[model samples]
Target: MGSVLVIGSFNVDHVWTSDRLPRPGETLSGRYSSGPGGKGFNQAVAARRAGAATRFVCALGGDGGGDLARALAADDGIDLRELRSEAPTGTAGIYLDEAGGNSIVIGAGANADLSAAFVTAQAGAFAEAAVVLTQLESPAAAVLEGLRRARAAGAVALLNPAPANAAVAADLLAATDILTPNETEFTGLLARSTGTRVADDAIAATPDDRLHDWCRALLPHGIVVITLGGAGCFVSHADDARRGEEAACYRLPAAPARVVDTTGAGDAFNGALAAGLTQAPAAPFAQHVRLATHYAALSTERAGAAAAMPSAAQLRERFGELFSAG
Candidate 1:
């Protein structure tokens, strides 16, 4: 197993808890709390906790939020040397409804200011990694550039396309080794400005129809992993060089747990998957997928994003059965 590198964003998440989500133009009072988040930070913590040598390459503003972000990274034992300081740290205003659902509005702030040069400067760090993880929080060009370098260095590149954006390049998708997206994001990426919405629950219950189509379309480019949230996830790989219909598909059920805040759950899955790949590079793909599911389930057992992440021992203790079976 080798090191894991994450290039993404860092943000301080402000969470408000309420009985129900407010409608448009509506105001509601709720309890508020602050914690460490951002897809990059959460995933780096997840990978480190899963017993991987993990480092984070991200940009932060020299503000109060940046202080907390650095402290959180230190606490998780994630290497912060590659982390850059620019504008103020980013923030997200989050609202959590009674059923554990959430709505978030992000202020990119310094996250949007991350430049291609910053990514290029960190090429040496990426070259030393066995797996490189990225997301859509940072500039698309920077993320793609990092992927290109990682590929040239013989590292497996895993990309999570989130917070739906239309600027993603097709060439970047082709360069990715693994592409993970939730049901909503999957629809948004394909529809591209059509405003089409796919209910999360519907995707989980009947993923074969809609998700299969989406996965098939991307098989020509690379592997696709569509997350169905509680119903687990779907994996698709190209069938053969001659025939596209040779695409193979599989689904894994989510590990059972007492539901809490779901922030960073997908990031947890991706990070764990990357770590599992390093630990068991020669193992069957299903084994690695199962390990990721277990890691993600343990993350939702607590509150907050980075705070809820569990160490390798905790995950093995709670989810040893699943891994043993695998």
Candidate 2:
């Protein structure tokens, strides 16, 4: 199998599940739970369980959170490369509604300490990777460095411009080979890239050609995959680089699934997509997206973040007829 290298953050997620999300200053009683999360770590675990040899690089503090990260990485068989930091490990507070919608607040402690130099130093990992995946959870400089090195090594550089508010520069956009963004994030990027504001709620209704135009403008030379929740996902590619796909842009419906918790669903998609790309380099790009969609839909059936990701065997067993072996 092929390998994937992930550069991002690891957080101890504190979650509260309630019948409905609270309004400002309105107190509500709910059930509390905690577990491993962080966009980077979630994707790393997803990629590994999706059947890729995965490597995760991040920064961690000398705390219980850090210990949890290390122990979980070991359990998942991910090659962990972390930098020690004096700051506390990162954390997130998440609130989940009965419908599985979530709102999160992050405390980016040691995650802010991931440096460009540290990312650049992992040349060996970058060199051996078939795909190098990263997100904005870490410092922008560090994320940019990882993407650059992935490009230099001829690995497919995948960027998930998540959390909606993370500042992504033109250089970072230019360096990415594949860009995955949910509706909110795509709107944020569109506003930043072309000064055009399409509300997140309107993304699913936007015309494919119009969406393709915005996607092309955002990353002129790369592929853009916009995940649109229950509406499924939209894929846009440069005319010259369709990755053997017949259409320059297309939409795929989400697989059938019973929803529970929506947290980490996007991470599941991204990780499974990376696994498919690495293990089946010659398959049509849509095939990878299909696997990602199925995997993501399956993830929502469970709770938590990293712990919610389903294994490749489980994916096939659940959607075997829909997702053939890569």
Candidate 3:
């Protein structure tokens, strides 16, 4: 087992809990609260709480949001490596409806200022990590640099291309050892990478074999894991040098939980997967995904992003039956 490293962004999230999502030109009032968030930050916290020795790297501003990130990282016991910039700290406005669905708008701020050079300076972290995880919340240059360095170091490079509305570079996709995306992000990636428009939810209800075929078409190499909410996750393993047909596919059932806020469930899955990889590197790959899936389900039972992550004790207590160690 080895360490997990997360290179991403940290933002303070402002949230509104409403009865329903407001449509265009409609204004609605709801309960308001602010907390720690940012896909990178949330994932780092999740990894730490999932029982791994985790490190987080990101750029934070000098404002109150930055200070808040620092304090939260300390409390979570996550090894945080942050670069300081002149810009204000990043932020996100999240709207959560009664059904636990959410819509978000991000303000990059200092997150946009994170440079490739900064990531390069911390090359040793990527080199020493067993798993190096990154997302699109930070600058593209920085994300690519981190992934390249991680791959060069022979570490498992995991890429989660979130906020699917943006275009991801080919080099980044090609370098990834593992790709995790939701339905929207998968469709967006295929459209951007190969000009193939696979309709949204085209294979959401299909069998693992079908999902594997689609993932193979999208990425001939590397591992692909797509989260399909309550239907669970589809994982295709094409990392072996054998033919694509030899690749194995797995479907892990989603854990049952009382839903509250789904804002951070994906981050929880990514983080817990990274952590689980470190905790049991020699175990079957599906083992890691199962632990992560259960952890993510529990995350939705809570309300806030980072706040929703279960502690190591809580995860084991609640989802221990699914843990490989059990």
Candidate 4:
């Protein structure tokens, strides 16, 4: 089986679960917890549990935070390619509410030092990948190099542009085969690509045809998946069979989940989606999306980032029909 390569970050997540999120200048008391997380690390764990043969590449500091990352990856049976650096390991501050909502802030640390040269040195990994997954937590040059390497090797390249406010290079966007973004990131990407102000509500409210039109203008040869919390996800893929302006679009309903903390739901979806794509290369794109959505729903039932990912056995036991049926 060709491996799914995840090029991203590794961070220690500090979490506070409270009745409600804190407001400006207000310090609220809440339960506290800490664990390993980072978009790259979280997604890699999700993919591994989703039953994909996976490898993860990231920069790490020579510290206890990095030690935790190594330990977790080892337990998950992941192939970890670590690049040690002088900076401290990255970290995230998370606040979770009783309503399953979350707010987070990140300290980039070693994640910011994933140089393009390092990615280029890992050429063999990219060449052997069936799918290449990345997020914006790492440096831009490194992210761009990873996408380029994946595309050059004919592997499916998926970009989950998170931290919504970051600006992505045009070349990086052009190299992407699949772009997964939450509502906020969607708005940001569109605004940057079109040089016009984009409102998040307008995107959620637009009809399918209009959305496809925007997708075509943004990426002519790729797919765009916009994940809406409760309304489910909207997918638009470029159709080669059609001429000038045409694409396929669909809206799937949200999967049932007993909500806990929604901290890593998006990472779960992207990882599971990548796993499904790698495992069933011939299956319809919609089927992968559905499986990913269901996988994400299951993830939210638990309360941590990487720790919340459900294993293949759990998925089979709970969602038997999901994988066994057509």
Per-candidate TM-score against the hidden true structure: 0.90, 0.98, 0.95, 0.96
Ranking by TM-score: 2, 4, 3, 1
For residues 1-326, what per-residue lDDT tens digits would candidate 1 score against the true structure?
A: 57899888888999998999899999998889999889988899988988888988888888899888888888878887434557679999889977778898888878887777888887668867888899999988879987887898888888988866535667778778878888877776666533445665566666465566666675465567888777788877655421122337778788887877787788889889888876666666767777888788888878788888888888878877555322
Model 1 Cα RMSD, 1 decimal: 3.2
C-alpha lDDT score of every prediction, in listed order: 0.79, 0.95, 0.88, 0.88
Candidate numbers, best lDDT first, in rank order: 2, 4, 3, 1
Any idea what lDDT model 2 has? 0.95
State the local distance difference test value for candidate 3: 0.88
The TM-score of candidate 4 is 0.96
Top-TM-score structure, candidate number? 2
Candidate 4 lDDT over 191-309, as tens digits, reads 78976566887777888898777777777888889998888998888885121223388898898889998989999999998898888877778888888888898999999999999
Find the candidate with the highest lDDT and give its number.
2
Q: Per-residue alpha-carbon lDDT of model 2 for 1-326, expressed as tens digits?
A: 55899999999999999999999999999999999999999999999999999999999999999999999999999999999999999999999999999999999999999999999899899989999999999999999999999999989999999888999899999999999999999999999889999789999999999999999999899799999999999999998779989899999998888999999999999999999899889989999999999999999999999999999889989988556545
Instruction: Show model 4 residue runs off by greater than 4 Å.
Output: 241-247, 324-326
Candidate 1, residue 216: how far the Cα is off, in Å: 2.9
RMSD of 2: 0.9
Tens-place lDDT per residue, model 3, 32-132, is: 99999999999999999988888899999889999999999999898889999899999999999999999999999999988899989887687679899
